[model samples]
Target chain A: MDPDTAIGGGRDRFPSTEHSLLEAAAGGLAPEALERVAALYWKPVYRFIRLKFHKDNEDAKDLTQGFFSSALERDFFARFDPSKASFRTYLRMAVERFAWNAHAAGKCRKRGGDVAFEPVGEDAALTESPEEAFDREWRRQLFRLALRDLRKLCESAGREVEWRVLEAYDLAEDARPSYAAVGEQLGIPETSVTNYLARARRTLRKLVQDRMRGVTSGERELREEMRRVWK
Target chain B: MEVNSDPADLSDSVVDHLRQVAGLPDLSGTRYELEGEIGRGGMGVVYQARDRQLERRVALKVVEAALAGEAALIARLEHPAIVPIYEAGTLPDGRAFYAMKRVTGVRLDRYAGAGRPVAERLRVIRRVGEALAFAHSRGAIHRDLKPQNVMVGEFGEVYVMDWGVEAVGGTPGFRAPEARLDQRSDIYALGALLQFVLPAPAPAALSAIARKAMSAEAGCRYGDVEEMLADIGRFEDGLAVTAWREPPMHRVARFWSRNALLLWLLTAYAAVKLGIFFWPYR
Candidate 1:
């Protein structure tokens, strides 16, 4: 079943920007909208090509850039049907098919020009199947984008202490410092550290949920995606 | 430090994502300094904090930014069974949070499973009932009452936490099958709590009380928490409970069950007397 149907009759409760991006993509790939969509999905696409297709990093990066550059010119996103599949699944399938066609035509020529996408690391486990690799990379990208947004929010709001506390307490868990230690480092009371961490966590959860709207079909899918991303 | 090549776990990924996000300095201007996370639920995350002015530890429940309006309402509830909210306010980032006494104890279900005597369990339940009774008197209904929401404190304090989600989200298994939740719904949850605390094959008197509280028809349940508390009190004092009318045969059977060994010896003596009486004839 289409995940949208499971989320109660495809009522789009997400913000209008996501819908507008798709509409623009369908109406003839407006440059600004296509760029936004590309920026959002490029990391996942590049990682999928590198890990799933076994292409070297440079070739994978060039192919990812080439696919999006061509997809914009050829109106690739117009083919996406919300009733058929989620945007994430559709994009993954589209990228995979693009890779196969490129290899078939022997046109794997470098054409990235000035795209400058982030490099795909070699750390992804090779044991995963293509679908698993695509999904893991996609979720990782979503997390990366959401984190970027959260940083912007914190910077805008001047909550740097809360952000630092969260970084020390949550992100540095391998060598996790006690709240008292973080407090001493920050020159604040331990209780303040705890409060800041809680605030940061709550804000991050909201921001991640907001970012998930672009890919999820509806509220149910959004919730499911959030659970998977944060699980 | 060596970085692991494998992908980060879900929790680690979340933390990494948070770290990457732009952070803000401490913007809250509250009296309490947060210590650490105490617990979390569907509505909010609670932190253990120290109230600087009061010089005491408190559980600060920071609710979702959208649900900040509930903090004041929850703060108004002043009952021993309910965690008393001392202060409520919005953080600089607009999330709603409140401070209440930090209850140090396990959840009710965990406390019940600790092999405590039945009397102790009943006493704890009674205290909880008293708390609920107080809330009901103040026209507050704890629509989300459950074993998890009830805290059994270290010094035998019974506190019912998480009143923010009252009349909103009900636990699937504990909620009554009612169109509109009211005091009866809380009563049903209390009945469920009794079943959770009582061991299998609970004594007939207590089971009857639980059954009446969990009656399918709302009208058939106790008139109020006070009535239920009264029945529990009666049971504790060895008086006949109002929940069930004991039939003459049932009472006799219960008495016999309670003193089975003594009854068996008396019966054996009677049988021997009869046998001796008949021995002369034999």
Candidate 2:
């Protein structure tokens, strides 16, 4: 594949591991990998349908789920050539193509065929282009998965206080409590609140990076992706 | 809320996830309000925000929590080429964020990419050199000095950014081949930037200067940004650059090259006058 096809520069030196995911799926060594791919991309596909294709939420959800099930059954990933494009771009193109074919066949609302993907709702207004919406949704999905993992980590480690502190301060848009306020609310000292939040942010950042690495093509692309995610 | 398996709840959670990933801080209580993201780097993301108390817009760089200390240190740097930090504080989440003067212009790479005149590009690079010189004088090294890290304002102002990653490490392809990074490493990066902005087959004198700055051996590069700036100044003034040892023939060629238009005009004038003078003789 033309390394430059990936996002950032220095692709020649640092190849991304995303290709391996495709390879594993194509080789049939791991059905779980394909399932993971479906889980990661389903929301972005659904969002693309709703925003770009102008489908309603219910129709978008059905089309998204149906597309994934059909693609998996047909071994769609095996046809992907990383040399031709980055996995993100390739997957986006595949989703668009699948949606187009389904629409042509008048199967946009045919539900219960297979692949019962989770229902993801449309949140923000469609202010961006379809491509922009797809990219943004992709990033949101990555963050959501990373956050879920972070929550698991916190629960296992008995760091509910830290998790709550982060949720209040980082996640809450209304009444974002200060460190002192969070401390008072949680019955901890302000200094401890600061330390816990710091810990949580660090852990979250690492988890985000780890999740990004799974999809990105190389170190440079990973850094570029992370920068975009933060931006 | 009871155990809810409602699809609407799932959708609400998705919206909540979007809010967190948006990285928009609730600055309603703070003096600054988030406007939008202007730029981003590995260390931090910069948002264009309005300082409500000050009634002005500023660029707020909110770094990852781990780099908070570095952000604070960068706020202390004062230079014309460096983006001036107006204030430093933490988000409620404890991430280190600082407000700086919001510059309205493109990155140096983009600015240079527009095919601006060579002189203008050099001027921008010189401003960056001035910033680096001041920084090194203050015992700080800008380890990352690529074109992306430099911003050029609409009014011809230049500002260096992302000091949060300063002296931390260098960007790939710009990193010096040295175990210990210091002032010379920045000089090397300046050389890379010069190569990036300068036209292909750059003037012999300027290419030599870039070569010296990007020398493999750290000691071989310019000792400081000022010295490199001086060489650039000399090159701009049509004088022999310190970086290049021009032979007499090459110096004459360079002189001709610099004054090619004037020389062409002079040659035309002389030919016209000579033709008139020889008219009667003929």
Report the alpha-carbon TM-score of model 2 versus the true structure: 0.53
Candidate 1, superposed: residue stretches over 4 Å from native = A1-139, A150-206, A212-231, B1-28, B53-55, B166-169, B178-180, B216-220, B237-247, B253-282
| Candidate number of the best TM-score | 1
How high a TM-score does candidate 1 get? 0.58
Give the DockQ of candidate 2.
0.05
- The C-alpha stretches of model 2 lying farther than 4 A from their native spots are A1-231, B1-28, B113-115, B166-169, B255-282
Interface alpha-carbon RMSD, every candidate: 8.2, 8.2
Number of colliding residue pairs in each model: 10, 3
Best by lDDT, which number? 2
lDDT of 2 at B237: 82
Error of 1 at B111 (Å): 2.6
lDDT of model 1 at residue B233? 82
The DockQ-derived docking category for candidate 2 is incorrect
